[model samples]
Structures are given as structure tokens and as C-alpha cells.
Target: MIKCIPMIIKGVVQDFDNNACKEINLDSGNKIKLSLLTEDSVLRSLNSKEKVDLNLNQIVNFLYTVGQRWKNEEYNRRRTYIRELKKYLGYSDEMARLEANWIAMLLCSKSALYDIVNYDLGSIHVLDEWLPRGDCYVKAQAKGVSIHLLAGNVPLSGVTSILRAILTKNECIIKTSSSDPFTATALASSFIDVNAEHPITKSMSVMYWPHNEDMTLPQRIMNHADIVIAWGGEEAIKWAAKHSPPHADVLKFGPKKSLSIIEEPEDMEEAAMGVAHDICFYDQQACFSTQDVYYIGEHLPLFLSELEKQLDRYAKILPKGLKNFDEKAAFSLTEREGIFAGYDVKKGDNQAWLMIISPTNSSGNQPLSRSVYIHQVSDINEVLPFVNKNSTQTVSIYPWEASLKYRDKLAMSGAERIVESGMNNIFRVGGAHDSLSPLQYLVRFTSHERPFHYTTKDVAVEIEQTRYLEEDKFLVFVP
Candidate 1:
């Protein structure tokens, strides 16, 4: 069977002639056809006027309702989307379902959205109206058009990017990743399903063009952007940076790695389970997913044994996605290299998972499918040298209290986020991503200054400045 995925332009579905459509072969032997948008069509779509004007509360409510629909397992769109993921991306049933649940959680949590605005901009109302600040009324204005270059490894990332732009009241022009084009389209369809004419829905346009194939359309689109949010590996990030207009604000969510630190937990089983969850949640694909474990203190062998059991359990519960021949070869070679290097190697049956324990802080190419490297250290501080600011993202710590002791050092070492061993995937409210609040980059903070009649904090009165300058009284007024 062939599935035809259409582009969503300003809340309308667009279908092109068969000649303009490209067919993609999926890992499950299924096929999907995507219509390519012409330059004129995209330009026209971009020029279409925004249909409705809505406030923050209205947009949130609409998104919440859409989220409620997705929360239902039997919702037609949600079910179809999960099935499509399984068919097109080779995701296991459980994994696909998990992704749907995450989407529900992201949208339904309305407070988090408001909190993001408040935390980054100093007031949630800043987006809707000018709020009084010191000596001025400040407002956050949406940077006109936001162009998103999404990554495929994590579908929720693209959704988050679009949501941020919407929350800031910016027009969104999303370029979907070829590896996973269905997620953003499905999200836009859901918006249309809720209310086609809603301003938030009408402000979004989701489409795709092969990266680097023809630079004409991308260049034109980049030229029109007020801000650009780029996500993916180094190459993709570079491409976005290189093509973005000089006047546009570019935000990059590039490649990052995470790790775990076990500081002699009281319950080795529980600690091991947490670490295993971090390792298996996204199969080490997310930046927050644990790639290495630094075990401090004793019971290292017991922790490893328990981790193995937990990993086996996850294999049956949330089975991994399919790996191509090259991936399989890389996994096997990494395991062999560990053995050749005289490191302790442990693997699961049928290559379900692999763990390599090294005597020192040694590293190599990570196969990244439930593969973890463990290093033994006498103290947690020893892990600092391995943490690099430019590339380190989340550092998970066992025995939650241990975080307080090492968080300062970890932050100084370039770790962007610190979380409990099991909570790597859940980004809490008020936390910074990639060392910056993403919303801050999507909008411009404009301040309305107070009138001259407003008195200065230092001086008693605000008289004419020329009079003070002519009288040589500026020094007295400054005091």
C-alpha cells in the first residue's frame, strides 16, 4: 500500500500532480508519496494573509483541546499516526504509542507553556500586553517569520519548535526532515482538525525540500525569515547557518551527548533501573539519553548485573527499532574492539544490548542502540575532565541528593542540564535548554519608555535635561 502525505500551507492541505510527487521506501517495505511544492506555490502560500487574530489563552485552549483528542488511544488521527510511524519508520508498537503519549503530555500541560514565557521573558503577559518593568513597560513581540529546520531522530523536537513559535505569535515555516516527514504534517493536520481557520493553525506552513538539492527555494525562504531555528547534526546545523540571511536571528540545537553518574546508591537495583531507563528511553538518540556511566564507589559489579536485567526487561517491553546492515556491522565492531582492548564486555542475547566497562575514561565510536560504556572512578569529581561545555548536554546523577554537590562543577564543565538518573527525558519547567531559554530567541523584547515626567530613582525630580546641562547641575542631579 502507498500512503500519500500532503503539505499543509496556512491550515490548508495541498496536493500536487503525480509528476511533482516523490516516493520514499520505508524500512517495513511500505512506501509513502510526498508532494513537492513549487516556488510560486510556496511564495503564494507565504503571502496569504493570517486568517484570525487570537490571544494567548485562546491559542492555549485550542491546543489543549487538540491534545485531549490525541490523549485518547482510539482517536482516529492518533491511531492512524501511530500506525504510520510503525509502518514508515520501523518503530515498534510500544515506541510509537509512547511517542503519541508524549505529544499528549506536551500539549495538555498548559501551565508549562505559560511558565516558559514567564521564566524567559519575566512575565507571561509580556507576550499578550506590555507589562510594567523598571522605568518602562516591556513587551515581547514575535519576530515575524520563524523558519524551523527540524531533525528526525526525535519527532517531539519539531513539534516543540513549532509550538514555541506559535506561543510567541510568530508565523511558522517548517522544513521537515526527509527521514521523518510525517510528524510535523500530522501535527498540523491535528490543528486543522480542531479549527481550520484558527489563527495559530493559519500561521503555520509545513513542507519539505531535499537539503542541498536546489538552493533556490531555501535561499528565498531564508531571505524571508525573521528568525531561524535549526536542529540536527553538525552538517545540518552548518547548512542552516551558511544559508540564513545576515539579518535573521539563528538559533542552533546542534549535536550533544549526555552521561550518568552513580554515586554508591543504597539500592543497586533501583539505581541500575534508572540508568537503564535513561539508556533505553530513546535508544541513546536524544541528547539527554545517557551514553556513558561513571560509577563512583563500590558495588560496580552488582550495578552492572542489575543494569543487564533491566535492559533485558526493556527489550521485551519497548523493543528497539530496526537497524540497517551498516548499523549492525558497527555494533559488532564496537563490541569486538572492546574485547581486543582487554575491557570487560557484557552483551545481551541476540545483541539486544551491549555494555563495555573500562578501567579508565576511554571512549570510542558509540553504536547508540542501548549501548553504554561504564567507567569506574573513586570520586564524582573525576568525571569533570570528560565533560566538555561545547558538547555536553544532560548529566544524570543517581541518589538525587548527589546532584547538589556536583551540579556547580558540572555546570562549569559545560553540562547544560542536570537531572535524576531516571528523568533524563522529562525537561522540567523553568529549566534552560542548550544553556538558553528557547523562547527568548523566538521573540524580540521591546520596551516602552516612561515619560520625561517620571522621576529618576536617584534624583528627586526629572526636570529639563538642557537646563541641567546649561547650569552645570548634571553632577548634582546624577547623585
Candidate 2:
């Protein structure tokens, strides 16, 4: 008999094998079943009758406590996660362990809550008594509830989605990705172990169902939330946007194409190593991962040769775990296309690594298994046309100084971020993402404006009638 996975409802995990279960066999030789959510539980959350008034500080403290537990070798949370990865996901020991450690460190940061206050409410409002205007008071509150449709690319994404919701004091109902079914479950277990009665624990519900045309279930989930944050590629984002009710707001972090612009200085080999790390890390699945590299100098042969050498080094150190049939099929198709298109192709044994040198200009053709497209350009301006506002995300430039020199231009050209060549995968916690501070969007800022003596008001400081409206979300701060 196959071991059955439990379906989570309102923080309760129970056996759910009545009838509406969908069985799926993971690429890693594990068979799993997904059960439907309890209908009443879904409806009750939508109604919002049970208001959860949890203090944000306590929630942060609880997360800090959870992070501290990582030090306890016997009580480590990563052991279970690592087992899950090996059983059903494609993460190797190195990748799985790194994710667990990084997520623990991220949970320890106290700045996430501060960003909500500093970015949403003015920095002056961090202290209850310290006033931004000496008389006016302001506090950022939750938008009632948020439902997140998380992606399966990285295990830490589930933790990230929930952290933002809880920090803003919003109740959440998380829908985990099919590719990574055990990530949220492990974290939820941590929360329950610490304190089951904590309001933070009670306010969250982690559930999953097979992706299908069941509008009834998703509609109920979306209708009940004040906002929906959909983190996925184009297809997933479109699905959520279509199913969500018109009144509910949705934040779409859709598929984006990122690239590395390298100015080959004297140390050409060192430059290649930097670009190689960006390609190998995360298997090129992350939004910030560079899919294409634009080399701006002579000695193309030496750069490509060094890049191949670094890739071989990574293959031994940070090796890939497994690939599903779809990924394999994609590799085959891309290799054939590159060859037929008359592009110079360089690959390893059995398609382990493939490089298409000077491939034709295109977007969304990435094979995504350490397979990269390299382009040689006489001038950097050649890349400007491909920076489409609809899809560009990060532009990692060499030497760190190029990022500063080209930051404003890249921003204006529609790229949201410009990081150092080797640091594309790293983003500071509580920092702006996709050009907006995440906490700013997760909250609803409420102002306690003191009445100005009707006599005199400085026009410069007077409240502006118009504020920026983000689709259905209005982030208004009287200036």
C-alpha cells in the first residue's frame, strides 16, 4: 500500500481518502494523492466572520524562535524537508540543505516587519508616540486576508509568501505548488509544535489540489480574500486572474527574462566564472537567473572556453539531482532547433550542458537545465531593444560598477533590477521586488489625521487629493 499524504484544512492535517483524491506519481519515484479542501472551511474564511487580532511583534518573535531551532541538531526542521526532496522532488542534498539553511536565516531577520512600517507607514511612525507631523498618527493594517498561489521553483517561496502575509497581520490560506508539496507542511509543523493556539497559527491554512478546471473551489478561495498574490509563470498568472472575482485584487509576479551583461576586463576567466555561477545556480529557474549572456568585448573564444570550464567545475560541486520527462524533452527540442538554425552549439556528454553561441534574437526559449544562450555584441546598446517592459526583470552587469553606471538607463529601459554579475540570485530581505517594496503592497495604510486649525496650511505639505492606484489597491499617503 502506498503512503497517503494528508490534506490540510484550517491548520488541521487529516487523512482525506474519501473519494475526491487525485493521485500523481512524482518523477522521483514517489506516489502521492491530493485531496479536496473542506467546503465549509473554505466558505467560513471567505465570510471573514472570525476576526483574528494577532500582534505582529509576537508573530515575528515566533519566527525568530523557529529559526533558532535550526541550531538544535536533533530537532532540526530540515531533516524532514530533505527527506521529502529526495523522495519526490529533484533537489540534491546540497541544494536541499542550502535552501533549508537560507530560509532559516531569512526567518530570523526582523527587518521584514520594519519594512512594512517604514515603507507603508512613514519611517517616523515606527514609534507610536513619535509623529510624522507632530499631530497626525498612522498605522498600517492588513487588507483582511490574502490567498497566495505559490510557485514550485524554490522551496523557500512558500515561507516567503506566508511571512509577508503574517507580518502585515493578514490571515492567509496558502495553496502550495504541486512540484513541492512538502515545503509549507514542514513550516506549518514548526508553527504547530511551537504553539498551536497562537493566533498566527490559527490564521493560516495550507492546502493543495490538482490544477484543473474546478472554478468552484478557486472562486470561493479568491472571493474570500481581499487580495491574491499569484507567483508563477504566464500561464499560472493568467489562470488566477481569470478565476478571481472582479472585486478581488491580484498581484501578478509573472514570467520574466533576465540576462547578464559582461564587460570582459583583463581577468576574462574570472568574469566567466561569475557568469557561470548565475547560470548554474537554481538550474536557471529563478526569475533573476540570467538566461542569456551578452559579452561586450573581443576574445570570445577564451570567454566561452572558461565558461565551459567553470560549468564543469560546478557539475562536480553543485550537481543536478534529476530531470523530469518534460525537461528532458525540452532539452532535446532546443538542441535540435539550435542545430537546424545554423547556430554554433557546444554541449557536454548526454546533453548534460548545452550552449548556443550567437543564437538568433528571441525570448522564452530557455531550456532551463544549466543550458544558456551566449551572444556576442559590438556595443551594449544592441541589448536595449530586447529589454521589453512586459518581461524583463533583472540585468546583472559585470564588475559591480557597471550596474551603477547603467542602473537608471536599465530601469528606464524596463529592467526592474541591476545586480552585480555573480549576485543576481541574492536579494536583500525587506527590499523592493519587481520595482515595489513588497510590504508596501501587502498592507493597507490607515491614517489618523489630526484636524488642522482651519486658518493656515502650507500648500507644500497639504494632503494631495490624488494618489497612485494599483488596479484595485490604492496605497494613499497624504503628502
Candidate 3:
């Protein structure tokens, strides 16, 4: 355990300021001090220089290399880091291992990284141009400087924003969360293991300060950023937005909840198993984790029973995460509500999992820890209004074909994405996120005009000739 958390400034570790540093363990048990670096020095360094300047090819290679270091068994950092997360944050071994696996899956592979590049900035130029332009050409460029206000519910958020910033060749400063502060350093260590002097390593700095109402360091950093990416609940997102000045572009990934819709045709047992997986994974802390399960079927009881069995099995495999007093009390309140409403309630001896089948109404605020709220609906449409288009993110459907049929309706209803059941959390880097090409939004584009390109008459003639030669292939650039 790092007793004194190191403060990173311009790729090197800096000493703790005796007057500024304060040590307090927020009951996480693996105690460490918060490295409260002074505002003046950090701001001076940020404004003084541009540390990153890698071309697209070099950026791709750099990330791929970092991934190899994490995946390679010889490296002690990845394994030790994951174990530390489990110990420090009270995550179950399975959950911790799963988190590690996700990192490897998402970042380690060359294909995934390339997928992101191609999907966002088409062909290193204009992508998916519905119409063609003859004179203009466009290319994506970094936004110069970025600040990421990361969320603590999951450690993955820290690395994800880092990847986007680096891939886009932007110099970035990551404000790490109190809950999972170690990931930023672990990622930097992984990069150092591969190539310490690489532009990405040199350009990135990760540090932390307590979230205070008075808006100090974070607000100043946000105000100066070219791009500010905030990941958190509604309140946190709002706070970040308030600090961000007009010139700074802000992207908010706020509190989102996902749900699954199961039809009667689907196998009840298999459906229950899928729901069990989503609920049990991450101990329900992840945004994509399922809280409300809406079923359109007659075998609700059978599905509920199978779900209980699966939860019982997973309880043994991935034991319940330790909870603080507040969390435990919240769980008790939800359980008592179920009992008071006469909803069928059940629990294993370990109390690692809880099931409230056929709850008449569920609290918008969920007790998200191995707990589930099942709602029986005669028609799937009954669940639509509750989805609350603004807040609801991913909606999983049972039958694969059904998703195809209901996709448009779901989109019209404000659902961001519709996927097959059990796969709401699994997404390709190139795939639409929050119904957007997220990478594209992080970048700015530079437009170029070829010298006196074709005249109006020449352009018309060129279009006709081009149409005759290859009608299907085309390109367009927005001026």
C-alpha cells in the first residue's frame, strides 16, 4: 500500500508538500494521503508547454504497446494493481478479475484501437459522407489540451478517458477519483514499462483533490481546458459544467441506468441467468448494470426462481462485497419495503444477494448491490414510459430478432441503444456510445482547400465523370 500517494507533474513523481498534504482514510481501510498539489504550480506548467505531438500512427502503436505490457505476465503491475483494487475497494475476487479482463479486452488488442480510429474519423479524412465534395478536404486534429474529471464508481473510467485523449493526440490532465485513485498511476506505470519517454507518457499527468463546494483547482483547470470530459452522477456533472468557461467544450457522461426486457418465447432459465450475470457483475456499481428487469411473459415465477438459483450460485463464486453502514442501512430499507408491500422476498444465508419479485413499484433510487427489482408487464410498451428517455441508457431485448423490430420504436422513445439480452455492457470501440461517435466529439477538424480547385462548370463535369466511373464511392467535407 502506498502510504504517501505520489503527485505526478509532467510525467515525473513529485514530493509531497508537507504543508499541503493531509492523510485521511475515508474508511476504505487501505489508508493513503491525498496529494493536494498547489494550484499555482500546476497551472503554470499547464500553460507553459505542449508535451504531446505524436502523429496518428505513432499514437496507435504507443497504446498497443502499453496494452501488451498489461497483458504480459512478466509485468507485476497489472496483477498487483487488480488485487489492490479488490482489497482496497472491497470488490470480490471475481469482480476484480473481471475488471482486469475488461481492460485487456478493450485496450490490449490492436483491432479494437483501430476500430475506434476508423469509426470516428472516417478513413483518416471524411467518413461516411452521404454527399461528395470536389474542392474541400477535412482531417481530425487534437483539441490541444483536455481535462478529465473521472468518476469513482468504476476504475475503468480513468483509463477510458485517458485512451481517448491520447489517441486524439491531446495533452491531458486526469483528475482521479477518491474511490479508485490507484488506476491512474497503474496506467502511467504500464506506459513507463513499455516506453517512458513516449509522447503519451510525457504528456499525461494524473492527480487528485477533494471535491469541495468552493470550486478551487478543478474549476480553474476546467476553465482553462480546450476539452473537459466529466464522468459522474447528475450532481457531479452539473458541478463540472458550472466551472467550465464558455470557450471550453464539455462532454458529460452522467448517471445512466440500464434494463432488460424479456419475452415469453425466450427460455426462462437462460433469461434469468443473463439477468443474474448483469446484476452480479461489478456488484451493481457500474452504470450498465441492470436494476429493473421488465418481463413480458407468463413464466414470471419460473424466471424468478431460476434467477434466485443463479444468484445463489454466484453468491458462492463472487462473494458479496463489503458495505459501509449507509449502504447496509439502504439495503435494509429496500427489504423492509418489499416485506411491507407483500412482494415475495428471499435471500441466501450469506445475504450476498436479494430478490424482490413482482414489486408493485420500484424506487427510482436503487439499492444496487446484488439486489434486483422485477416488474411483470403484460405488454413491453408498459415499460417504455418508465425508461425516462433522458436518464435510461441501454435497453436489452430477449429475442435477437425482436430488437431489430423494436429498435426504431425504442430510439423514438429516447432509448440510446437496443441490444440483445446479456450484452448491454459489451460494446465495440467503434460502435455508437450514448448514441454518438464519442471519439469524433473529442476532436476538432482542420479543413483544407486545394488551390483554386475545379470551377462550377468544371465541378459539374467532374461530378458526371465521377458518377460514371464509380457511382457508389464518394466523399464529402463540411466547410
lDDT of 3: 0.73
RMSD of 2: 6.2
* Estimated TM-score for each candidate: 0.97, 0.88, 0.89
Model 1, range 1-479, lDDT digits (tens) per residue? 57777777887888655776678776566787877778665686668545335678887888899999999998888998898888788888999999999999988989988887789777878888888888999988888889999999999999899888888888888899877888898888899888888788888788877775777766887788889999999999999999999999899999999999999989998899899999998778898899999999888999998999999998999898877677778899999999999999999887789999996558777999899999999986789988999799999999999999999999999999999999998888889999998898888889999987798788778767888888988887767
The backbone clash count of each candidate, in order, is: 1, 0, 0
lDDT of 3 at 313: 78
Specify the highest-lDDT model's number.
1
Highest-scoring model, TM-score:
1
In model 2, the clashing pairs are none
Q: Is candidate 1 or candidate 2 better by lDDT?
A: 1
Query: How well is each residue in 96-120 modelled by candidate 3, as lDDT tens digits?
Result: 7777766766566766776677777
Looking at candidate 2, the ten consecutive residues that score lowest on lDDT are 453-462
Please, what are the lDDT tens digits per residue for candidate 2 over residues 1-479? 55456655555665666576667787877787766666765664565433456555666788788776654545656787776786678788878777777777767776755554565455624332334454566666677778888898866766777887777777778888877778887777777777777777777777776557566776777777787888888888988898777867788788887999887657777788888888888888888888899888887888888888988877877777688888989988888888887788898766667888864375336788988899888776887877778688888888677778777777888998787877877775445678766666666666677653322233333343343343432333322
- Runs in model 3 lying further than 4 Å from the true structure: 125-134, 359-365, 451-453, 456-479
* lDDT values, one for every candidate: 0.87, 0.73, 0.73
